[model samples]
Target: MKNKFIKISVCTLALSLLLGSCTDDILDEQSRTVYTPDYFKTEAGVIGGLTGMYAHLRYMYGQAYYYNATLTGTDEATWGQSADGNFKDADLSGVGNLNSSSSRSDVLWNTAFSNINAANGIIENASAVGISEALVSEARFFRAFDYFLLVQTFGGVPLDLGSGELKFNVSQNRTSVRNTVPEVYTKVIFPDLVTAVANLPDAGRVTGGATKTVARLHLAKAYLTYGWWLENPNNIPTYPETPRTDPDGHNAQWYFQKAYDIAIEGIDNPGPFALQPTFYDVNVATNDRNNEILLMADHTESSEIFNGGSLTFGSGGAPDNFAGWMLTWNYTSLVSGTTPAWTAKVSSVQREAAQPYGRPWVRMAPPQGVFNNTFADKVNDSRYDGTFTTVYRGNWDKTTLIGTNPVLYGANGIAVEPGDAIFSFLNEEPSQPIDFSNTTYNSGIGAGVLPGRADFVLPPSRISRRVYPGLWKLGPYRTDNAGGLGQPNAGSTRPFNVAKFSELYLVAAEAAVKGAATQPGKSARDLVNVLRARAGKWRYSNADNAVFIQDNSAAAVAATPAVIDINYILAERSREYFGEGYRWFDLVRTQKWNELAGTYTICGPNLTDVTPQTFTRTIQPFHYLRPIPQGQLDAMDMPDADIEAYQNPGYE
Candidate 1:
């Protein structure tokens, strides 16, 4: 009644009926002020309950819980010193050190359950009020979404489907007993989602809201994860030490076919969906709710939500999207001025507007392994440039002087010449061996020839700690409104994409490799080529036009392994979905968690300095499933035996 932000208690539902009686009186003021389980039986009440659940997601995504839990344990990123061991126990080599007491884990588990519980309320009370099938289906979609994340993270959890009455059963809440991963999927996730798919609106749902196709997209992904969970060829509890074994009754082919069929339906069904012609076009701020995104978590700058766009994580401001802030490079650390002395345009009124660009947290960075190993042709892969900002031309106007004296443009003065190459990130690290004559750096200041020295590339003069390449994909939109002179708390307002239609291509390709059904006139090769061809077109047509950005021809597709193996598909995903928080789940679902984590040399800025030189710890098999948050285990009102039984296998 009072806009559902008012927190309700679980005990309220269980005791609601007991507080009611067969009495009719004007003294029933309690009914107007407080919500009982019976309130959810009404249409307005059901909608309020659903709105509260959605609002919780907005808050949860704004927090560090989801990204911290998912991003660190993968190959793409590592827990840097800035995080101060936030997810370190889980991400580091001493896998056994991670126990049930981790606060971050506690945050993730509790936040998700809040949404799951809210969905249960809607489903249980819908029939009593005769709620529409579509609305109930929306509630089911959210329930399945929460359970999907739970099963993936915790393996098994209490399967609570409110039976007949909204008792909020204390026993169900208190029990630490866990279900099997398969049981959770089959019993809870699959059924609810199937109901969601059958009953949700057929089309034209809002971008951030649940639609039939959105349900189908997740349902397909569930099938894919299920296929791998059964007889996971790569699931060696201890790998290299232990041999890979295909478990009995692993009908992977069956599940892959089911996944392939569903994915193809989503892709081929006549609807408003197609891959954006350019990778940049797909993710830019103007395209926040574009056709490419099947589902995304929406955020706004005006709302008192999280952190602002350009400002780093801890700086005081209203709630803005901190995801971009966390991944952004420490811009303030780069330049040598207290008050920013650089302005690209001479007559600019917002001359000091460039200050916000220096406000990033620089918490995490993309692993160098991806640039070297995954991007076989990063120069031509439109995604590389679309995703990363490799060059930083000086925006400081020449007239600005430093050191309380007149400083000129050249020789130690703080003036940027018109053609200066302020920052450069080579495709290959300088320490690695390479052939000299043909090697060239696309410094955006013409070709940079490799120097004679073997220790590093480009003189050490250009290789300062401040020159690291920041990810541009999640950058704060630099519009006049957003990039105003003193736009306080102006940070990211972009939607965080949860599912994209382009990912379906990769899914379809992987399913095809695993002996599943394929789309008509579309092989795995064709699907990958479509994306590549789009990349090639963008490379040639875009403004950053340099000769190095070549197109992927038919021959390139033929040579590529996307037509043959899973490794290339994983590699392509690394290229496409870098900072979108897709890495951990992608690696886990594919069973490549241990292998890639062991193989790749992930590096980040050192603890005391901004040098991109710290290496990550090797990953272990137990990392396939995140340890149950210690707080959950401590909070559960159960015996030690039940807690022990419920804890995932390797975490103990």
Candidate 2:
């Protein structure tokens, strides 16, 4: 009888039913509220169940541990100084092992199946309740969405979740069987998305809701990924051990062409979505949920109950948008002197609710290659500036540590006010030598003093695991705090953007690069240039903390090679969507994981350890697909050999 605004806990009992024996360990408590098949036949139950589908995204997207699994081992990131087993294991560099127990992909494993079962319940019964086909399509989109994620991560996940294939299950069934890659895609993901695209409305039913455009985007991506799976260019092994052949007898090229066609169609049908004028406008905290973002795991600052997590503090668990914190170094550790002679030290960069500063978990750090190779052209590209928090400005005035002193002594014994730059991560090595030996003026966190600047600086080469440029794109933003830091410890309220309109271009370009026939002006090069040109325009400089207008679209376009390849597309994707959790999937899809991220360079974990060291990852063939979660294996009431067969090869 309640509306969709009811929390996920009250709407569905699928978590317990789907996981069976694992429920006691995974969920806090078995949900007392159970929706019968008959319950879903009612209008209230159908609406509330649909709401649960949208609400499930929080359990995976913004949760920091899962975020680490997606990017930490890739070329984009590595484990940070404060990393525990969760972060270190994901790096695959011998610090820890990525077993079924340790893999953070469990975040998806634990959350998605329950949501899929819930979606099945809604899709089956909502039609009986006279729900509009458009409304039911939302459930279809989510079902397909989860399957797409599962097939990519675990190589052949169970589509039959205690029910018949894609059917709603009322009773708990512990035994499970894995489906083949082609079976999962052909039977579940592709069909549901195709139906969703046909029946769904042009505009989203609600804010951040599934729509025709979003469904098309996922379908195109699904095609692209499956095409890669079929090609298996690197001869990577797959679970369930099925041959790389489409059930429909379509070749890899057929899927690639379909992917390109659908992505371009989605781009043409711009319903309430378009690229932001400049790339900077797309990610600036104030501009979140803008037209460019097609879908996101929605969060709110208005109500703690509805937000699904605490507004003032976060536990860094599921349903909390804390992914931003992992890439954020402990900027609060940066110290400044209260007097000009550098007598007493104070925390200059206090944690704040503003865009650049948030609670620091320090679980992940970017490698030096991110600066030296990926974002090498720091001059014309606005993305490098928009993506990283290079400048740590003074906010000691907000803290009692500065007391009566209005200014703090920064680099070279220069005075800096409340808003002045206290420390900076230089885009390139300075012409004037940085004095790392000046222990008196050097920031304790591996920062060195430049001659004239008030801010201590770290060149790209000196960036270490303990201190690197924080991810500015995904940082916290809050308006509730008037003067003081407002809940700096709370998870970010900004919607963790899952899909963007700009990505449509990247997807289409990738498909074209993989031998898809190109349209007249829509070749791989043209599609990539669309994003590169946007990267050249800048309205504001995040590093300078001031208005900066520049348009080098000509230069950016000119820089693109005459014939672009998959490696170039990957590089462009990194430049465009860096630190937003796309790296691992990108590398895995192209089978370039070991090739691109085999060895990475970064300074050691300690503050004074500035010399770069290269680390190697043992990226065996089996590492392409993450291991199935141990909890899932433990829940299955199957024979030992059957269970062993169910797990991915190396993880067992």
**RMSD of each candidate relative to the true structure:** 8.0, 2.8
Query: Tens-digit lDDT track for model 1 on 1-652?
Result: 2111212211112211122222111111122333346667777777766654454454445355456556765677655435545556556644325666663555446656655655777787888888887888887888788778877766666564222221232233444345556666776688888898788775534445677777788888888887877657865342112222223344768778877887777787726667887787786566667877776655544432221223323332222345655555543322322212222212111112232232355555455565666654655567776776564434344224432222212212234343233334565555644332322222221213333321112222132222345556666553444323334234455556777888777787778878886767777777777677766545332224243444565544555663467777887788788877777788888888777865434433342232335344656667676777665666566688877766766667
* Model 1 quality (TM-score): 0.77
| TM-score per candidate | 0.77, 0.96
TM value for model 2 = 0.96
Candidate with the greatest TM-score versus the true structure? 2
Residue 177 Cα positional deviation in candidate 1, in Å, after optimal superposition: 2.5
Q: Lowest-lDDT window of 10 residues in candidate 1?
A: 20-29
**Candidate 2, 1-652: lDDT as tens digits:** 2111224532343534344322111122224355568867888777767777777888888988898889989999999999999999999999999999999999888888877877888888887879999999999999999989888898998877766888777657778888999999999899999999999988886766788999999999999999999999999999899888888999999999999999999999978889999988999989988889888887778876667778999877877899999999999988888787788888888999889988898989999999999999988889999999999998877766564568888988899988899989898888888888876785768688877888988899988899999999999999898777789999888889998988889999999999999899999999999999999999999988999999999999999999999999999999988988889999999999999999999999997688999999999999999998888788777899999998999887
Model 1 per-residue lDDT at 648:
69
Model 1 stretches astray by more than 4 angstroms: 1-36, 60-62, 94-96, 161-173, 236-250, 302-320, 336-358, 395-421, 429-467, 478-491, 539-559, 602-618
The lDDT for every candidate, in the order shown, is 0.55, 0.87
Residue 389 C-alpha lDDT in model 1: 57
